[model samples]
Target: MSVTIDITGLPQERIAFGPSPLAELGAALHALSEPGHHARLHGWTTTTAAGLKPELADRLHEADFMWRSTRSDILLPAQPRETLAEELDDLDRMDDERYVAAALEINCAGFYDRSGPSPLVDAAMRQRALDLAAARGPRQAAFVRRMLADPPGTRAWIRRLLEDCDEAFFADTWRRVHVQLATDARHKTELMRRKGLSGAVAAVSSALTLEEDAHGSRLVVDKLSDGRTTAQGSGVTFLPTAFGWPHLIALYAPGWQPVIQYPVSSGELAGVLPVETVKLRLEAVSHPLRMRLCRNLARASYTTSELADAYGITAPEVSRHLAVLKKAGLLSTRRRGRYVMHQLDVAAVARIGSDFLEAVLR
Candidate 1:
């Protein structure tokens, strides 16, 4: 009935947590592109309707098999990779044999009921892309052909799909919302530090939840893959999701470290910014000078003098406004060599007036 991840054999020290850009990106892709998952993933449809051109929609609908109901193939985490480039780099590090094997594995109806290894694919490797291309569905076949001909290019295309959908669906919205997500992720990290490993894993979801059993730790997720998999010396990583709502995705390639992604707590993801924070954010744009400063930083990060020179204001005034926005968490600053650059939090303005999410749903 559920996939039991036996971590009893592994050390507690091996349990880890971090967010995966690939996992989140894959979930966003499915939520935005796949027709079969549209029911639970319903939120993305109206938001992406504008940017999803007719031709792209047709292609996505037809190529649904590549990102099928399970979506396990695309969720593989050979190692703990937090960025897109890092994940793809990890994929490339996989031997051709291992890569080919994991690429074809799927989660099936029988998988959940089995005591044995997954019944999705053979242990023996095959020419993965060619095999997928030979599938009965023309859409799947076409999609596989494209992947084979240009692997990097295909991944880039998929990335663009996620990015474009995020932009068009929300009207540059998710920025501020993401700050909440990041804040939640940080809180979870603090939980793990205080409560130990079990509490941390338990925090991810109640629906597709994680728990400890006599055998080891278990992750009960909403999917067909229902076989117990042992860490078998390879550890597991837990990642938090911000944009990836309503779905729990996992990576269980037979020979690799597993990664389970769960939705962050909604309580943390939503709710108004504190009244004071909201007031400060509003004030950040009220001044013609502050508004201009915020607008310039929106395009690119700037130093105090760089901003002052651009706006014909003095460095002192620029620094003062930047200080207020930074305190509001509406701007992020990072030190680069000798210069400290402030970047517009982008998530700043929508703290209140923009009901863009509500607009998308309508």
Candidate 2:
């Protein structure tokens, strides 16, 4: 069975910023702050009577050009400061177009050559595979069976099958089968339950199969105890065009909102800036108790009890706040005998400070 998914109702608004360039830059930078946000912000279009507005079209074109140009070779160093400082310096000196181009070039290069999938693509594919596995279970089983039966088929035939199959069918079926086989073959679920209920939940939730095409056979197991079908041979291949850009744009861009938005202030937008830095600075200084603790540690690293005594907080409260700061990457700890001494993570603090400054300046 062939299934086609039509995605519609994409956002058509032209990309517009506040009156000031600074405000615009801030919004754009903030949008890129979160993972995958840049792609969504830069990858949409509006069908206006005037044709594409020059500025909006230029921004979109630039984004794609940067993405493709750097996709093959960008590497982010372990320390973000080294890269971020250089990028910020470039932004300070260059024109908007040059700034955006350079920043995106570095971003794309770092991301593409990194050790993982692009955040946007990874989330999209995972959801797609899950939906496909759930919705067309039987059809997926049939497809797998056909593939196994004809390992040496022409690329054209394989492409036709992949394109024709409903988007939901294969993923839904694959997920169901993948889970059941994992449970039955490894008794993983049973073992997880013995560890704890949370473990059992995680085990059951770990659905979906990750297989290289070079594998000899891919098995589809039926949870209803119906049976199993294994696809044999060289495996199936899919064509790029089968995954159309329109469908992808629809999938990734669900709504038309800018990846980042800046709330306009009453005056001219020229002075608008990110308030995150101010917030962070206030957070760093606001609590007298936390400040005391920080001051004590600054003199020299100290155990929780030592700082707690100096600050007059209970041991538990001190531990709790320390845990929070540590998770924020503001603090680092080391065990010295029975005591865990706490100290600041300078690099993390610097990065947080720098990011705030950049956002505000933008």
Candidate 3:
């Protein structure tokens, strides 16, 4: 029997960032916005600022010193809700052209160093400032208002504005925005944090371009820094023995590139399936008693005796099933007090399902 379910009727809400100069400015600032939430993002500002003109570099340094000495109290707070909310409201009320001009001016002033102002910075700043100020309200309200005023074509004005902001201001603004975002989405941030540190570490790793190995069956993972592992054998069927499959998938999805690298030793078998592994996975999946045990353990950890009583099976039968599943990499065991508790290996199960389907199709 086959089951088919169509999901075409689902409603989707698409988030569109419109073309206002100020809005573009805001969007550009997004990378720098959230501060305390992402420590890795700090590199963006420092790295970008290193290449600025000499005068601008001096100004950035001065601004950093000034900010450290004077505004430390305001900037060091755990949260800046009232300030951010006010800024956002102001940005919403501004006109695109005017807001863009104002933002540009702000950026230029922020970025200008002791060498004096450059025409590029001056022209760009004036344009953005006018774009932002054209709209009306408080600072943030005006920013948003201007950003939403026109179509995205005016984004050039905002980009120019960002380029002129001194490194100090750019970094500071980025941190502020990041903190606001983190405050708004505490739950998601916590979940990501618990998943493991691999994602966070990878985000900051040096970029490496991947290429197919000579064998045509594997991708070589290279461009590693320091003493980290650079390459490993990888495939849809190359199941992980630690942390199971879900964690592995999360770590190696398309969006999260440069993960585990494929080796050159594996020969190309483009359409071929690993029949033996598939058979093993299928047999693992078809064991009804094992499935029942997994479902029960998912709710709460259970001992063989407890599981046996719950499922109305003998203690020895439960033990046998647990042992088999454990050996199959579908379950994990830990001893608590005098009893051993069992839990489903969620990652392993997911990998088994994925590998089984892939093998059958191949």
lDDT of each: 0.53, 0.30, 0.35
TM-score leaderboard ranking: 1, 3, 2
Least lDDT summed over 10 consecutive residues: which range in candidate 2?
243-252
Error of 3 at 305 (Å): 1.2
| N/CA/C clash count, model 1 | 3
Instruction: Tell me the tens digit of each residue's lDDT in model 3 across 1-362.
Output: 11111112211111010112222123223323222111234475456545556765443333231121111111111112333334344444544443333333322222211223322335554454343233211443344343445424334433333346624354454454444333423432343366522232232122222233353222222211111211222211111111111111111211111122111111111233367755665576577666556644432346676666556789999888887777776677887546576866544554455433222211
lDDT of 1 by residue, 1-362 (tens): 34566676677657666655556555555555532223444455555655677866775564454344435555545344534566656555545334333433431221222333321233322243344234324565565556545555655665455455445443343443455555666777778779876566667665445666675666555442244566767787776665554446566645556667766743211347778876776675666566556544543456676666555678998888888777767688887656676866534443444332111111
Error of 2 at 357 (Å): 14
After TM-score superposition, the amount by which residue 265's alpha carbon in candidate 2 deviates from its true location, in angstroms, is: 38
TM-score for each prediction?
0.54, 0.21, 0.25
lDDT for position 231 in model 1: 74
- Name the top lDDT candidate: 1
Best by TM-score: 1
Model 1 alpha-carbon drift over 4 Å, by segment:
34-44, 54-63, 76-82, 107-136, 145-178, 207-225, 265-362
